[model samples]
Target: MAPKSDSAEAIVLNFVNEQNRPLNSQNVADSLQKFNLKKAGIQKALDNLADSGKISFKEYGKQKIYLARQDQFDIPNSEELNQMKEENAQVQQQLDEQKRAISEVEGEIKNLQSNLTLEQIRHKEAKLQKEVKEMEDKLVKLRKGVTLVRPEERKAIAEMYSEKLSQWRKRKRMFKDVWDAITENLPKDLKEFKEELGLEYDEDVGVSLQSFSGLLQHGKK
Candidate 1:
């Protein structure tokens, strides 16, 4: 009861444009079966549509997929196009904001995972506070000249100081003897030679052996 159609190419082109999606030769063939069109005829029609640039296609090995070309659609007016552009810009902005929010949430999650728990943090803070309080109290006592050293400790410190002073005196004498022996026959000026050799005695840098003796006497008071 239906009229016979002659143009397979026209039917295939119309079908592809109407679908507006990618369709392989077999898909077109199957869909056109109701029109009594063979696969080979559908394939040939699709190829013709592609060749004439009425539709776009991609080939995967022996198979071909056809899609309707966007350029084949009617152009929108300037006002409509501007409205579409504005809508696209708004969508893009929303997408960017969503991405930023997602990144921030991910960062926060990682930070929380890496950080110490509230109970552990409080415990560490309390320990540090106790240490700081102890140090501060000791510092205040020291500033007030409080005698923290025991009598036995003071005696031991004095003995150590005396032994160190004896060692210093012996080493200084030995150094003087060595210096006299080495420079006895040298013709260079003694001060210039000492300077050239980068040598410095105790008094050269504002330190005197006499100062240590004075300090030892002052500590007794």
Candidate 2:
């Protein structure tokens, strides 16, 4: 019987640690049953174990979800398992926060419904529905570990970057052409002078022709 009790405790610990997802009280009870452990024994063991930070027993209404404390749980060859468990904890926390917020908004919506006229109630309902949709979308993104950027928002941002890149490329091309045209119109005798100055005529004729022509035309000695 002692060995049996030890096996049950190990099973309970491993289940919560392994799943690492939230569940309500009934769900936890169901898991305990599946492990073939008596519900009362498992429940008692869980509660006591939780006090030592060995597990987390979160109560959502009558439902309880048990998660193994990352600090306490261990599995061999589980690389960065602790980090993964911590992330799961954060995700669970975020889910609870979102649920609370939705509940608050629902209460507000109910209050507004009671106070508003029929037409006003219709408007409020529409607004609330829109807000709920937005919140649901955000929740989906959170679950996926992605940030919710609306389609319109992303399109606007992409458009802005595209416009800037187009303009930048245009300016670069213009400057490249201008510089090429500059040396193109260098003085016919400039090559000899350049060679005399020991500055190799590596620029070749017609190099930077446009700017060189503009400079010569505007800056004649």
Candidate 3:
């Protein structure tokens, strides 16, 4: 009975196809040692592959040398090489355009930060954030066939950004709530206690009220 075509046969054939050179069963078995396949199993897979016409073999005395069929591979000619070069140039041009777009957005963000009103800044920030996300999606699509970044690395970066964005959003809501609570209950004589209350609150440090009079006395146990 012929040996069944299984993972062992597939692995052996893939290695043979990639090598494109005549390899003995021992050679294939050695190359696939990491798979922990037994020598007998490898020999059986090799025979199955040869029988299935997935590979060809030449008998050299007592041993058979196996190789993938040459016709299965497309050997690129000059015209094909030129077409690949043109495609590569077009991808590079697209990459350059993306970089320019990112730079323009960054510059606009900086300008808005320096000169825009608070409400305008928030509006523009939200718009720029959306634009940046769209640009990132485009970058991921463009990098599909290229080796600029590995898939794992891209995933890690995306996760990191998502985590940071979530934290920022949480803090923004917290700060807004705290500001509202402090403003609504402020004393009518705001100018007299303005310096004592230390009204300058930051998102990172939170609401810093140096002296809230008797408001915080209840929690002073």
Candidate 4:
């Protein structure tokens, strides 16, 4: 059902006062469409309110822009304005601090990602422990004088082991040569550079080519 003309005028007046902004007849009509007020009725109500000084308006050519009376609102004093400014400054400072804290937390997360996770560390530890256990078992067998190789296979096995060991030494030397060339002009020391690259030598893992040297010959003797 359509609102009566007087009720429509009252609705339009309340809308203008609540919005407290300059609005044309079309703006008022569109806003009041939900109230079942016709566009013509809304325009008529706006005009009546303006004529009665119930709302203020400014004429721009053929269009009139209506606004609520500013004299009805209380203006803030100078002290109140200063207090509002201080409150705004404190809120801004809190926002900046939160941003800084978020940035720091993000940096820490990136740093943790660069290092090994707990699972990876546990996996590596398990592998090293397994290797240690194998070595200990081999030592126990050797102490019991258990024959791990046939007499005929001893020479062949020793020769094969020696060849493989020589190849390993050659590869190690080649790697060291390449590493030296790469790090010749680098600012970091060799140890730090190797650490940064996660590179490890045999000695770092408690094993060395020198320690394995003459193993077969010593056993034969």
Clashes by residue pair, model 1: none
Model 1 C-alpha lDDT per residue in residues 1-221, reported as the tens digit of each score: 22124588888888898999989988888888889998988888888778878889988988688999989788899999999999999999999999999999999999999999999999999999999999999999999999889889999989898888889889899999999999999999999999999999998889877778778888852
What RMSD does each model have against the real structure? 11.2, 27.0, 26.3, 12.8
Lowest lDDT 10-residue stretch of candidate 3: 212-221
Identify the candidate with maximal lDDT.
Answer: 1
lDDT of 2 by residue, 21-79 (tens): 76444566686775676778777767766776767777778766677676654654666
lDDT of 3 at 24: 96
Judging by TM-score, tell me the better candidate of 1 and 4. Answer: 1
Model 2 — which ten-residue stretch has the worst lDDT?
A: 212-221
The regions of model 3 sitting more than 4 angstroms off are: 1-6, 82-221
For model 3, residues 27-137, the per-residue Cα lDDT tens digits are 998999998899999999889888888889989999999989999989899999999999999999999999999999999999977896988989999999999999998
RMSD in Å for model 4: 12.8
Reference-based lDDT, residue 49, model 4: 80
Name model 2 segments beyond 4 Å from true. 1-5, 32-35, 72-221
lDDT, candidate 1, at 167: 91
